[model samples]
Target: MKKVRKILCCVFATVLMLSACVDEEIPNRNTPLGNFEALWQLMDQHYCFFDYKQKELGIDWNEIHDRYYKRITPYMNNEQLFEVLCAMLGELKDGHVNLGASFNYGRNWSFWEDYPENYHDSIARSYLGHDYYIASSLKYKILDDNVGYVRVESFSDAIGDGNISDMLTKLAICRGLIIDVRNNGGGQLTYAHKLASHFTNEKQHVGYVYHKTGKGHNDFSPMKSEYIEPAKGVRWQKKVVILTNRKCYSATNDFVKCMHTFPNVTLMGDKTGGGSGMPFTQEIPNGWSVRFSAVVFLDKDYQQIEFGIEPDITVMMNKADVLKGKDTLIEKARDFFKD
Candidate 1:
């Protein structure tokens, strides 16, 4: 019986060796880039929102999906995948179409993970509330000219109202108010309303959020201003100036949208980073958190303003201007009011 068992083991070992020699190689299925195409399709179909620009890309969505996806897939790292995805999405010139891993397998990450840091240059530091400000917090300052200035890094409600009120009060005392949304990645819409209420004494409709429903878009206009704020009764009611750049996004963009409704509001600097929607996050089985556009924003005119809000006063920053410690945009704004 022992000899027979030994013979059977020898025969099995020989067969396994032969099979191994002839076996086909299986591709690395877990490459982050390999999943790019699948990821995009999943996002398009299952994404909480649909962007009209997807159709406007001049390429078929499926074709665009297949081509760029094939180019990006095969990278084994998530960071690499993210880099490629960011580049690809930049083509759309819209901020609403964002990507993230689903939160299922314990992957908990915030959308502001890559939000720009507020270095708070000395001039900025003199005025902003630091300890309370998170990495995404907006920078509030009282400029040298008492032209109350607030550098909104992000549109987060987590930022204390005291900080917002403090600087807004300064702006109220100033000749004109300058709300800088440049490089602000955007956050909660409630914060947008909260910030806007400082400039608006009356209950005004800021913007409307729209989502894809059935065959058309679903409009979710947050017209019911939750005006629990009184601007601390420090009114900067004369002329309000908003400093916008390409990086001013999401709720910040919505804030600009609402500000546009007022005739006294003047937007200076570059065009805003256009994203006019509320984000909804979902968790996937892999513990990854994925965020999708859950809403779209439209102004009182019923225009679904997405690719970002265009500034009324277009100004660009020059390196020389920066070296001189001069904020050309702010200077331009101050000059505008002075004139």
Candidate 2:
């Protein structure tokens, strides 16, 4: 029920499809001012976070336009103008936003960079050892303590109910479950939704999604409530802990949001990397493509999660534990189950 596809990917695909049709003449994307105007207008009309950013980040679209517009001149080189345009887009502090060129790509990745990295690959690998079960992108095993450990790196790969049910049956006897999704930059929303469905046997309210309706920053369609129907396959019955970090963004963030609503599900670790905006793609006059968030996804109550979500239990990885090749979060979760 919660959104499965990231907004940007959906919109970008649609825009690419429409652009493929020969109904409209291709816009002149050769001049600096033309590209600048096109990018500026694209964000001005379709970018969904302006209103929220204005209140939260103190961004004024008009002022940003005025500043970036001055940098764009007919005589300016593409490299120089691209730098200015990228800078203009960077103020949003969004990871889903990017400007692509043949030689370079411009993006705002401060979402994860500005936060503490709570995951260590070596440490996690040590826990998985040499014989971990692989179910698509899901790496799982029953820990020595009889705790179910499942590490999901990304949701890009497709998985079915049969696979999920088989995994659940394998770990069925565990006292508890730990789902580690740290550093997962996200993939498909469907995977997130499907994985979350197993934790509940009833329909669960997840969040809301709204699309831009008009050019106005606040012009949006009515918010729609999203639900996650319970899985038809085997579901977990015991306490479950979802591990998170700043790198758990996009679909992973949505998965965390849905899991937070399940009874006995505890979200542990650092804040999530949020990318709740649906993105749309447009091109500049120079053939450079600009992608931005065009759809807004809200929490069940209509609150914004564009930045990220806080975990229920804020646990940072212990450095002393890492030296021992242990994930502090997983160990802590094991203790929780034993208790």
Candidate 3:
């Protein structure tokens, strides 16, 4: 299976947790520099990239210390110094980017709770129907005549088998599949790629990522190419209708990038919320972990979709249509299969 070239929401939040601290004492002014130094050293020592050496960034510790001293010598506290550090790091412009900060970390679905109005409103059914069954405990399903609709709620779940198994069973009888990912955010890019493989029978390269070298003007180099191959024992030899909205982000966006390689895929509904990139995280002292983007992704056609990815067939829901129980998005996809 190939990578989807997008990260998941949990992975992003987990990246933040890597640099986060909680229920801990604040460090002294001398400690911030030490913390930053330790973090930099740690990343150089353990980072997964092929080139994680300081020489790659063209900076020595002595020079970095001098630069920091000249820039923030007037600051009175570690907090102020840390702010400068954050600004310096943001220059990486990569996914999984972060700074050491206080954060609450746990295994709860906080995204849904924080944005209940977005998921529970009338749009939920249009995206994920109220009666949709979670078949195989992974993929979701709903019937729209000959078209079978499935809404992948998330990529990885601690309690379920995930979407791949569910999709295998449900897609067998349908003329076409409507994969709704309006607010999926993201999960594991590997899973996103695996799920996308079922829809594509031929081998194809999905996309590529370019990481920042941290040198001020150095151009990024290619990482590895993600690709897709056919899935054995679970073949969906039918048209794939992907339903997206502005909230479909990260690994979900990668799902879209991979689907474009196939001839059977068609995108419908609203544009996808684009947060496509490769993420990385490092643990700092005092249980604080910071994460950030280490790379940027380009689609197979070499387009960088950062803000959003538009639908092949655009459709938006209106208030009147909602009141009348008319799901224009689903109707549009259903009409496609009917034709």
Go through the candidates in order and give each one's C-alpha lDDT: 0.60, 0.88, 0.63
lDDT tens digits by residue: candidate 2, 1-339 = 236567777888999988865663435767887788788888888899998999999999999999888888889876888788899999989988899998789999999998779999988887888898988888999989899999999999997888889899999999899999999999888988999999998999989998999989999999888999999999888999999999998888899988988888998899999999867898777788889988888888777888899998889999898888778887887888888
TM-score for predicted model 3 compared with the true structure: 0.65
Superposed by TM-score, candidate 2 places the C-alpha of residue 269 at a distance from the truth, in angstroms, of 0.5
Q: Candidate 3, residues 300-332: lDDT per residue as tens digits?
A: 777776545778888776557567776667777
Candidate 1, number of clashes: 23
* Tens-place lDDT digits, model 1, residues 1-339: 999999999999999888866552322244564345444544554443344654544534456566676656453466666656555544444445555554212221222234332222453343444532322365555556766666776776465556566655545667777777776777787777666766667766654444544323323334433222445544447888988876777778788888887778998887765666566664333334445566656777766666667779788775575677666777788788778
Weakest 10 consecutive residues, lDDT, candidate 1? 103-112
User: What lDDT score is found at residue 2 in candidate 3?
Assistant: 30
- Which sequence of candidate numbers ranks them by TM-score, best first? 2, 1, 3
Candidate 3 lDDT score at position 295:
64
- Whichever of 1 and 3 has more TM-score, that candidate is 1
lDDT of 1: 0.60
- Please report, as a residue range, the 10-residue window in candidate 2 with the lowest summed lDDT: 20-29
